[model samples]
Target chain A: MGEKKFAIIGCQHNHIEIFIEQMYQLGYSCAGIFEEHDRTLAAVIAEKYEIPLVENKLSLLGETIEIVGCASMNHEKIDVIELCEQYGKSIMVDKPAVVNQDGLARLEVIIERNRIKVGMLLTERFHPAIYTLKQYINQGKLGELVHIGMRKPHKLNASSRPAWFFNKEQCGGILIDLLIHDYDLLRWFTGKEIKSSAGLVGKSVLPEHPTFYNTVNVQVELDDGLLTQLYADWHTPSKSWTWGDGRIFVTGTKGFAELRLSGDPLLGSSTPIMLYASEEEEWSKVDLIQPHATITADFLSFIKGEASLLTHEELIKASRAVLDADAAVLYKLIPSSKESEPHV
Target chain B: MGEKKFAIIGCQHNHIEIFIEQMYQLGYSCAGIFEEHDRTLAAVIAEKYEIPLVENKLSLLGETIEIVGCASMNHEKIDVIELCEQYGKSIMVDKPAVVNQDGLARLEVIIERNRIKVGMLLTERFHPAIYTLKQYINQGKLGELVHIGMRKPHKLNASSRPAWFFNKEQCGGILIDLLIHDYDLLRWFTGKEIKSSAGLVGKSVLPEHPTFYNTVNVQVELDDGLLTQLYADWHTPSKSWTWGDGRIFVTGTKGFAELRLSGDPLLGSSTPIMLYASEEEEWSKVDLIQPHATITADFLSFIKGEASLLTHEELIKASRAVLDADAAVLYKLIPSSKESEPHV
Candidate 1:
């Protein structure tokens, strides 16, 4: 194969940095860059990665680059991805590729008409602990899977964010932006399609940002009677050592595991994976298992006409699930009276 | 106050041990004991605490015992509590004081007719970490509270459990039996009544116990918009050092705190209360704060005609909330189809 090359058409979010670094590790060099709105982020990334900035997006899309990695604004992502699809290039982009149902519908049609791979920066799928958990599940270490609990709390860093970050119309709700990763992992870990999903949003801490919601909680059930809950917020306190304190809990009939992905607070920043199996005497910490290939590696392989670990259809399904969850957000006043009303 | 005295009327669950120990610490001697169902547990407690076991329950309830502590089978608790109320005696009991709505309604009427205090052994309320957290909230150290997450995982220990433990009708299902603590704590910490609560239950492990559910997830919204999620399961592996690995996460507008109550797996079983405030540099551990009074102390004060820390209304309210939550269990098939139907 000739030199594997990818071009960056957008750099609105810092996740583009992860996409670039992972691609570099897999011998896929950045061919060019283009960013119209967030030139500062684009410039910083260009200087750091030593990539030249293209004057226009088409200049990079028209080049011989086999992949386009876009981390544009949430609402604008579908536009860039559709453009890349029309250019006959596989795409890798940050989460909430489309902000709302309309954008998702448009992207679906674009994917149907175009024949190129699309991947998301759902980085948790490749976390060392999650990778090992997947192996254990496949090996039946955790017998019949029961429930999963995930928490992703990120520091808002409001002053550092662009204006568009606070606009719900442009950024999508917290459900789609923060919970999309959760929906993806629930499917990946269970290998079962989502049966139903629902979410509730609140602007507990960010009232000044009227259009923004700082907290979100989601509950999802899988096809085969497995349940999962996700809690995400933009309210991680400033004193938190990490940008986000992320963790995942996996339960099974034979055993259970808790992956402290980051911000252990007391136990250093190590991703401690604690396991308690039926035959063990006490809960023990499992060694971290780092996988050889990353998500970018699989995307690179897909663009190279090889089998993919994550397929385009799965990406769309997960995205659709979150968007639908966002749509079904309940604004009803939760009754405090003496009645048991079913509300999600 | 004239040598505070209490008697044990039921010992179906081991929690009676806590009830006895705490009452003794508050200078209340165990006047008598009565247990017909679990003679083994009753005999063990009798030998350990050096209290005599009475052949009939009324012998103790009819005595000058100012308080009756009951830990009977789930469905039989109301009968014991009602008898104690008829004798004009205050009572403290294990959780799920009543199995369902009807039981809650009956207990409500009994409490109205008899001017007696009733408290459930929602022990987490008095945990050093939780006590400290409550102090922080009262001190405005954690700004306006945003969200709370709690996990309670207990080793099923099926072999050691009574047969009634697995019967949903008898045990009140996992929602009421396990999540009652969560409901109580949610009210105690927020100091706000619950607006709505819902739960999903699954029998992930014990198929033989068809009437039992081993896993439960609950979501509650406070009247003021504070949100909380609770997860409880009976699948804690034998390797777990503690009966349950319980933890609580408290999020606020100014900061957040995570209380590792037990079974840290890596960290020793110290109840590490980690705090991350806006002004701090990093997450730091706070020294445990032991409260001067236990829950039983408060119950003793209530029985002695002194002001009660936990009002009878609050205990009944928390129980009613969980019972109502259990009634609204969604057996709806979570749709795996494209549409996102709202399912709690």
Candidate 2:
């Protein structure tokens, strides 16, 4: 419990580095790394970070690792999770892990059977603005929350993305891959489940890449009548330095707050949080208080058979709801004749 | 057509002055004014603008007036339009004139019989951004039109609103008086009719005002694959000078554009139009080319039996769609248990 070793199963998502860096800063030791097949990509990551590379999954699992963080290719995430669960190791996986219904059902079984930690690496959980927002709402600084508008845009380095990245069947479109973060964030911020939702999805930007849904938009109605509109796209033009220029606008009864995540890398910097009450003429930007240390500390406790920062139930439900949100997008769109033809 | 005289038939909405001022600047004569009941308000406006006040509706229509501008209360618009038509006068009226189905049906006949110049004074039509956008799209500078996201926030002078403003039956909630403007704007921008729409309306901000829908959010799907999201609220905090901090975001195949309608009067100014294309690394804020002169000139020409600036059919249809968009908000929301109880 004092200081546990954290190992990784695969290295596909860039978020893996965030987890590793955070854990390292929180005084955790690195054990070893394992990749299913792409040893070249694995070797590149291992050498870059100077971590030991293992021969096989068993070798990494058998090391001093008490917890395994898996950033496997989307299609292979479920299997990698199953392998880690069977070894009785607590696991942390990237977002949109089990996209399809079949994978979702398997995830439920693994979660219910084991007490080992299972967390989706929603790095936004470690973001300072989110914590600030929760504190504001909890203290009634902002009156009754009415609307949460989220924009989550990621820079899709098409060339760097693995073969599975373009497959809608595996990644569940732009809604799942990029937008799902907000779906979870809204729930955690509001403490209310989504009651109803409807939306639109388009692969508008990348006509040559017909299969990739580069843009997605959805409207979600919370159980308590809170209206939320979310737009996520892989529309970050190469000029931007950040991976995602995320944003959230929360409208409450007495006030409004807007969060510009990653400081609109397009602007070279985004204010982490900004708020304005009814009497205020200008928006006040709030300083971000990093939750990474606390988040990593919690994961370390979970690895030591203690309580997790976020409950397994909450994490599982968040993942499930995000996948369900994809259904809303699918049904809302009627196949346009243009879908068959390339966009002009 | 040679400097035709314009007359007013009500002085309820402040936009009536916007119409009068625009026409006057274009060399049209302000013949006279008439108000059904709010004569004190009408007389004050008449004296301030140095225009004479007529004895009645007939007196105003009997002048050198070739076209009548109506800014009657929401409930009285139909009567004013009917009265103007009987006198064989073409009319320009304030937005959301029709508050119900019967009003819409009656409006169709007024348009079908004669030109009657029944144009809804949608001034965003005159805003430099709309014209710049139209030029961009028409010149094929931006590729196929896709989505328009509109944020229209109107200042709620809660204490000053008339008795009818509180009644949805008369004013049609925030969706009717305010949100309807975008519904019309989107149609004009896309030149495509709406195929389907779904949304949520809430009395979220003003709890004391039970029946008033102070907040409304909607998603509209165009016949072709265009998507539009509109958020309207009477919740613009009292700190700003502009009555509405309105904005429109236009997304296209080759480029993207964002328009700030009134500029956040709080910031004291706004970028009227900004565009970014695939090759352009930074967003370019375009200089606004004022269309008010052109729009007013076109309306003046229409009075002489020439083509209308906006066709009657298109204008009426856009108005009808805006009313119907309200239906999407109606059905999407289930009455919350807390709706009956007073909110804090």
What residue pairs clash in candidate 1, if any at all? A195-B335, A281-B239, A282-B239
In model 1, the runs with Cα more than 4 Å from the true position are A1-4, A263-265, A270-278, A331-344, B1-5, B263-265, B270-277, B331-344
Comparing chain B with the reference, what is the TM-score for each candidate? 0.91, 0.89
> Which lDDT value does model 2 have at A245?
52
**Per-residue alpha-carbon lDDT of candidate 2 for residues B1-344, written as tens digits (9 for 90 to 100):** 45568899977877788888878887788888888776766887899889898876788776477888888887678888888888888888888878777888888888778846687776677777777777777777556655577777677778887766777776767777786667777777777887767776776544455567767788888877766788877766565445665667665555666566764322335545444444244454566666635555667666677765566766687778877877655522223644332111
Residue-level lDDT for B88 in candidate 1: 81
lDDT of 2 by residue, A1-344 (tens): 55668898987766787778777787677777788766667777788778899877787776477778888876678888888887788888877677767888888898788756677776677678877777777777556776677777666778887766777775666777776577778788888887766776775555455567766778887887767788876655554445655667776666666676765322335556554545354444555556635665666666577766566666677677767877656422223644332121
How many backbone collisions does model 1 have?
A: 3
Model 1 docking tier (incorrect/acceptable/medium/high): acceptable
Compared with the true structure, model 1 gives a TM-score of: 0.93
The TM-score obtained by chain A of candidate 2 when compared with the true chain A = 0.89
Per-residue lDDT tens digits for candidate 1, residues A1-344, read 47878899888998988889988887788888899886998999899989999888888876578789999998998888888878888889998888878888888887787577788888877888888788888878777777799999898888999988888889886788888888888888888888776556776445466677777777787887566889988878887777887888888878788877773656655444545455444576676678767889877776677887777777788789887887665432222222221122
Q: What TM-score would every model get versus the actual structure? A: 0.93, 0.90
Error of 1 at A303 (Å): 1.6
